[model samples]
Target: MGEEAAHRVHSRLDVLLAERGMTLVELSEKVGLSVVNLSVLKNDRAKAIRFSTLTAICDALGCAVGELLEVQGEP
Candidate 1:
């Protein structure tokens, strides 16, 4: 029950973008984030995300933080 029990964050950006018919490039331009950064988030490789960045993405995608991120347990 140490850091091992810490929740892992999972990103659902791909599904969300698909639902909105948006591409990563489009999202990047709209949210002012680089495609590489967005790709990291999309592929679940991002170690962390800034609150402002998350807010911007949410605003541009018309989604909530919960919709883009979810907590999961390590297997």
Candidate 2:
């Protein structure tokens, strides 16, 4: 088999929120989640997210999943 490639992905919430002139508290309220939960997501510490939650975040932020998360090739 060919060598497997490894990649890492990071969150763009901080940047996107800044661009939109929003704060984590606002996002949390809009997304119907707690600040702590949103912080986890914003800091890339979340392991899983519900589809409904994802949809809510997308709706609130006016962004798609692709715009929020990006892939980084192995260093």
Candidate 3:
């Protein structure tokens, strides 16, 4: 068998927020984050997220992190 390869995955935060009828601003307010920071996440431009921020987002969105992220083959 061929060796398995590692790959990077991405999130669909923008789409999810749209489906939930939520804007970045609104989510930011609810999650106690700045709109600018939320926009970075929404636009897939954030390099990393803190645990506290993740918890706040999950709590405000009523969703598990798994629902926000996915795995796929590397680019």
Candidate topping TM-score: 1
Model 3 whole-model lDDT (C-alpha atoms): 0.76
Indicate the TM-score of model 2: 0.83
lDDT string for model 2 (1-75, tens) is 332333256778899999999999999988889999988888877767888988898899999998888877656
Tens-digit lDDT track of model 3 for 25-54? 889879878898887777666667888887
Of 2 and 3, the candidate ranking higher by TM-score: 2
- Those runs of model 1 whose alpha carbons end farther than 4 Å from true positions after fitting are 1-7
Give all candidates' CA lDDT scores. Answer: 0.91, 0.83, 0.76
lDDT of 3 at 17: 86
TM-score per candidate: 0.87, 0.83, 0.77
Model 1's alpha-carbon lDDT is 0.91
**Considering TM-score, where higher is better, how would the candidates rank from best to worst?**
1, 2, 3
Error of 2 at 15 (Å): 0.7
Tens digit of lDDT per residue, candidate 1, span 1-75?
Answer: 564356388899999999999999999999888999999999888878999999999999999999999988655
Kindly give the number of clashing pairs for every candidate. 0, 0, 0
Error of 2 at 64 (Å): 0.8
Error of 2 at 39 (Å): 0.6
